[model samples]
Target: MAFKIGVYGSNIVESERALGLARELGQALAAHGCIVITGACSGMPYAVAKTAFEHGAEVWGFTPALNLDEHRRAYPQDDIGIYRRLIYVPPSYHDLFGLTPATAEQDWGARLKYRNVISTVNSDAGIIISGGWGTLNEFTNLIYEGKPIGILIGSGGLADELPVWYPRLRKKTASPVLFEGNPTRLLSLILQRLE
Candidate 1:
């Protein structure tokens, strides 16, 4: 089977450099025969999704949506320029076997957390571009869990110097989390690790 790479990032961007990096990272993953996995949202993740699809790579969207319609309506999946398929599951934490809902906000977060874990756990590795608090949480989860991860550095957002400041990343993450300046080379390395 092809290697699966869970892509972590946000649709929101802080600058042009960040967006450029995200696109390169996505293209690299697809070029190396690694399946691109995302939260099925937008921004960096979406950019990667498009590249993977365009390159004929198998793209999977592990969305937080309950169904296909919701994914299309609420997410940036209208045109599958890069992705091949979309899989929607409840993002609620209640789906975690035994969990009780506390409040409306908690319920919503649970759903996102639920899907995030599912996507990351199932992947052989991950790619973290620029992002915010949510991206950090996903990256941290994957690292502490001992998954091999790669970062497309210089993209700002989650890149440009992410691990330096985040102690948790240095502590739990198995460095050096493969950093690459070229997408193709980075993806090739990831594929080698997967094999």
Candidate 2:
């Protein structure tokens, strides 16, 4: 299987520079023959996934919703066609957790968090771009799973802040968390470390 690289970032990126970097990262992943994975949300992650897909790379997405209809209703802004495979939280899981459609909105936050965990755990490694609290949650999930991570330093948000926090957040795992401003070099470093 191609290396699955999970991308975590803001769902509402406003910076042109950060958006450009996300596009660059997507192109680089496609060039490297990596499968791009995201949370199936909008903004930076969607930008990366769309670019990667356009470049002939396989893209996978994990959605917080239980099915395609719910995914559309919950995330109407997200483009469904960008992903080669879009995985939804199984209905059995909802049944087990007693998460009915009526209660889905009330528990949306928890669903998104668990989706992050699922996506992060499935990835061979991850990259963080401009992001907020949700991105931090995904980053922590990667750290806990001992997956290698690449933080695009100039992308702003958590990407810029993570390096400063890394020392305090370092865990026992040898999994490397690299920070770089350039997407190509960062991806190269991540791929090398994976080897």
Highest-lDDT candidate: 2
TM-score of each: 0.83, 0.93
Q: Which digits, one per residue and each the tens of the lDDT, describe model 1 over residues 1-195?
A: 788888887666656877776677766766677788988787788777777777777888877777777667776444644456676675444655687768956755776777788889877888777777778778877877788777767666776567576544337445337787666677777767767
Segments in model 2 whose C-alpha atoms lie over 4 Å from true places:
94-103
**lDDT by residue for model 2 (47-80), tens:** 9889998899999999988899988987788778
lDDT of 1: 0.73
Q: Itemize residue pairs with steric clashes in candidate 1.
A: 11-42, 11-43, 53-82, 91-111, 92-111, 93-110, 130-158, 131-158
Candidate 2 has its poorest 10 consecutive residues by lDDT at 97-106
Instruction: Give Cα-based local distance difference scores for all models.
Output: 0.73, 0.89
Off by over 4 Å in 1: 76-82, 90-97, 100-104, 166-176
